[model samples]
Target: MGKLYVVGIGPGGLQHMTVRARQVIEESEVIVGYTKYIDFIAPLIENKEVFSTGMMKEEERCREALRLSKDKIVSIISTGDAGIYGMAGLVLELIENEQVEIVPGVTASSAAASILGAPIMHDSCNISLSDLMTPYELIKKRVEAAAQADFVITLYNPKSKGRPHYLKENIETIKKYRNGNTPVAVVKNALREGQEYEIFTLDSFDDSNVDMLSVVLIGNSQSFVKNGVFITPRGYKL
Candidate 1:
């Protein structure tokens, strides 16, 4: 049996992908991922057999990758770190015979933090507003608890055309514990094409541009904005 490499491509860009990930993909005989994700690394996968599925077909994709791994070294690709809402976990769950390796890559949260300054310098938590796999009520509780605990909240899958109001709901819940002045930063398509970074206060945030591709970083009570940079101090004397 051949090895199965789960690789994170990091926002679908060559510059952000780790060298190990690139090497694995190049050495693999087959590559598999979501159709759009595959397109992101299309330039590097010359002459390799590729399999792609549409959105919401994660299980099928994993199964296909595993099947391919039976005969060839296969790399299952994902955008951003595969362990965080990527294909790593699913592939692990379905792996029964293949030797698996994980190639980690940059996550959007870190990429966004780099662009927006140090908003996650201290305690922080990431929450996904999408309720496809998680229940909305449970997600809401997490939002409220993260806020009450004063954790720097990084939101993934903030909004989509199918679930347009989830981001607003999370912001409103954070307001219950945090004052409207809390610092908020939104980074869209971080390190990828058409990237955007904007800072706002809790009360002044414009949800018009937020979508599934955006990562929202909302600061805790000690967070602040200075000269267009959003920062959450680590409490060390400066």
Candidate 2:
């Protein structure tokens, strides 16, 4: 039986991807992933067999990757850290006894945090606003808990056409625990093409600027903005 590698491409930029991730893709005989993720690594996978599927076809894609891995070295790719809201879990669940390796890469939260200065230097947690696989109530509970705990929070899949108000509602939930002046940062296409980011206060954040491609980071009570930089103090003595 051949081995399967789950690779994280890291925000769709070759520069952001790990060397191990690139090596696995280059060494694999077959590549499988979502259509957009496949396009991200198109340069490395030339002359290799690639299988791509669109959104919501994750099961089909994972199964195909497993099937091909039975006799061929297959690499399945996910955009930003395979283990974080990526294909690593699903692929692991579907495999019977296949040998698999998970290669970690920079996650969206890290990428966005870097662009927004030290907003996540203290304790932090990531929550997804997408309600497709998870119940909205559960997501809200997670958001509220994180906010109450004073953790710097990162919101993924923040807004889309169908669930436009979800992000705003969550922002209100956060406001209950955090002050209006709490620093908030929205990063779009982080570390990739057309990258853009803006810092705002919790109350002044404009949800209209966010979409599925954006990552929202909100600071804790102790966080502050100075010299155009968002920072959450890590209890340093300086």
Candidate 3:
């Protein structure tokens, strides 16, 4: 049996992609992933065979990747960290004694956090507002709990064309526990083309500007902004 490698290519930039991830793609005969993700690494996989699927075809793509791994080394590509919300979990379920390697990459949260200065230097939790596989009510509960615990919250899949109000609802939920003036940041297409980032207060957040590609960071009570930087203090004596 040939080997299967699930690689995270990081957030749509060659510079941000981990070296090991690039190495695996170079070694593999076939690369499989969503169309946009595959295109992001097109420079590296020039001669390799690529099997790409459109959006919402994750399961199909994973199954095809597993099938291709039977005789030749195959790499399944994911944007950001594969283990976070990538193909690692789905591929793992189909692994049966196959030589498997999970190559991690920088996730969107870390990339966005860096761009936003240092808002996650303290305790934080990441949540996705996408209701594709998860129920909306369950997501709301999770947001409520995170807000109540006063954790720095990073929201992935904040908005989509069909679910524009999800982010608004999450903001409302978190506002219950935190002050309306708490700092919130929305980062779109982070570290990639058409990247945009903006900081606002919980009471002033604009939901219309967000989409599926955005990541929203909601700071805890201790977080603050200074000189155009959003920061969460790590409590060091300064």
Return the top candidate by TM-score: 2
Cα lDDT tens digits for candidate 3, 1-238: 6888999999998999998998999999999999989889999999999999999899899888888898999999999999998999999887776778999999999999989999999999999888988999999999999999999999999988888888888899899999988999999988999999999999888877888888999999999999999999999998
> TM-scores of all models?
0.97, 0.98, 0.98
| Candidate 2 lDDT over residue span 38-102, tens digit each | 88888998899999999999999999999999999999999999999998999988989998999
Segments of candidate 1 deviating more than 4 angstroms = none
Worst 10 residues of 2 by lDDT: 36-45
The lDDT of model 3 is 0.92
Instruction: Give the whole-model CA lDDT for all candidates, comma-separated.
Output: 0.92, 0.93, 0.92
The lDDT-based order of candidates, best leading, equals 2, 3, 1
Highest lDDT: give the candidate number.
2
Clash tally for model 2: 0
Off by over 4 Å in 3: none
Tell me the tens digit of each residue's lDDT in model 1 across 1-238: 6889999999766888999999999999999999999989989997999999899999999999898888889999989999999999999898897889999999888889988989999999999998999999999999999999999999999999999998998899999888889999889999988899889999999989998889999999999999888889999998
User: Once model 2 is optimally superposed onto the true structure by TM-score, how far is the C-alpha of residue 235 displaced, in angstroms?
Assistant: 0.6
TM-score computed on alpha carbons, candidate 3: 0.98
Clashing pairs in 2: none
